[model samples]
Target: MAFRKTLLAAALALSLGVSAGPAQAEVKIGFLATLSGSGAALGQDMVDGFNLALEERGGKLGGQDIVLLKEDDQLKPDVGVQAVQKFLEKDKVDLVAGVTFSNVMMAIAKPLADAGMTFVGSNAGPAPLAGAQCNPGFFFAAWQNDGQAEVLGQFATDRKYEDVYLITPNYQSGRDQVKGFTRFYKGRISGEVYTQLGQQDYSAELLALQAANPSAVWVFLPGGMGVNFVKQYKQFGLMGKIPLLAASTVDGSTLPALGETALGVYAGTFWGPDFQNPVSQAFVAAFEKKYNRIPSQYAAQSYDSALLIDSALQKTGGKIDDKQAFRDALRAADYASVRGAYKFNVNGFPIENFYAFEVAKDAQGRVSLKTIAQPLTDHADAYAGNCKY
Candidate 1:
């Protein structure tokens, strides 16, 4: 009778959030990305990179068991909202990570802010969030949408290209890309064109560029869109005629399909496979060995995102309940980044170096991003001044 009474008492205690068992620390993480359709490779690479960091840490982050709940948003805003709702209501994740598209990020950003959940973005940084709508809970592992473009634009300007043409998809990121490029580029823009997102055909755009006869063309297409655009650009004989400068339009994920067409393509990026930093070298070697493919900037950023979380968790001694405390920890940015030294700004964005990378054959004859020069140094986003947080 005493044993029955004790069991009942324990059950009541458990139901009231008191446990007789020892408290085990666990951190739940929700990862939302576009892991379907033609752009699947990008999201898949990001996830793989994130997992590799966990593998190195023995599947634990910051001495806490990490429960990663991954969901595919299918590149849809509504679907992304649904996934974020599930993460907040059902999964009760401590952190939300991995948004590969700006639209999707926009769809879920407000909810994450409202819930005060820490958001570590692996990809897709929209401008509004970085500026006026900035949330203290958000930290971008990747640069703001305009960051890469701004670097590439500076590269074009330095190259002394007098007349340059710009092309991007007609979306939030696309508009942001144009804004970023023109911010640093002082040269005349011969033409500015916007195509449909996930557009497969670029013949019309090519014709416009040909007619414009610009000295250089800066394209902001990504994923399969980049692949198609590069192939068509080569076919149109503009590959050699007009210099091609892009922001992540040609990368490791798309290089295999691009093959010879991607050769000599200049890009502006934050990290490269051949970067000489110890942590970066380690991550690059491990990622290539495990995936049997070169990791893209997307993958690099995702990996950094994981490392960032782990660093914060360690700082807080595996306790994530205190929002401001955890936010302060993340702001420290003390971890060794694959992109070398980086520090968080007042707006929770990174102030880091941006470099120009050219597609070149490595010792193994594999296509890789070879660091050319640092175009932008310790750069901070333009919209940071407007951030309330």
Candidate 2:
């Protein structure tokens, strides 16, 4: 009777698959961004794009369920640090991603590195992180802070612009922008102005720029500052009179907000709405359909970050616990990038194409970025040589 009972129990367990143990550990990723304040739109775009990638994969990465923890830093460095602490201590996330501003990124990067956490940058690759402070555990799905401006600067030099005025907020990224431009642009700079970070009014700056009598103006203001600067530029009747060149000042999300004021502005970026690759087309289509608007470069980079993470996880067979193995998988970067043919440099920053973009009205009368030229072909950041790793 005992033997018979044992055989019956074994059959029941086999039929029900009760011998299978608990399910796999959920892969948790914490996304910290400036989800509130002036950079809110940019941060929200990134979050949307990241989530969209996960949704397309049925909320699974490498056959493991994914749990995403999102927190708002309010564009404050101290607040970003606090969020990092929570993500590390409370959420117990396997990886951390997203930092829309360089100031916040700089504040939180060391803490994450100290904890031996894997960080995939969606935006805001500060110069220090890309150079002397490069960490093996860090990977960037976005360009370094200076790359786009470097392209613009090279274009300015090629165009033979004699006197140019430069403006950026006083911050890590701003300094990087100036460094990048001065590296490529041989023109005499009329002024190198550093405004307060997140400053609303540019009237005083604009008046000063007018006095400089620059043949062209270059700006790296992003988010709300871009909107304010561009709008004021138009209001001050300086739009068509002086050529406005920029790096993140006028982009997909900001262009819509700036409307007709942003028209004819020349900018440089790694991704455009009309990028022709198959993967790029698919991402742009899905993003527009889901959000009822075109995705910005910020969104495209975040989307790529999620896909890169998925590819790496799959390569490691979902064994993210093995940090070095996971890092190696990510460094391989085997997935298709929406930016097309992207690779990581020695410093873990992207080496990719940078294009010249002109803001124009689409057939549907929406302000958008049109790829006019490829200024920087297969460009890499300047800080890679300084990286010890």
lDDT for each residue of candidate 1 in 140-213, tens digit (9 for 90 to 100): 98899999999999999899999899999898888998999999999999999999889999999999899999
| Candidate 1 global CA lDDT score | 0.91
Clash counts for all predictions: 0, 0
Error of 1 at 151 (Å): 0.6
Clashes of 2: 0
lDDT of each: 0.91, 0.91
Candidate 1 residues lying further than 4 Å off, grouped into runs, are 1-23
What clash pairs does model 2 have? none
Error of 2 at 379 (Å): 1.2
- Candidate 2: where are CA atoms >4 Å away? 1-21
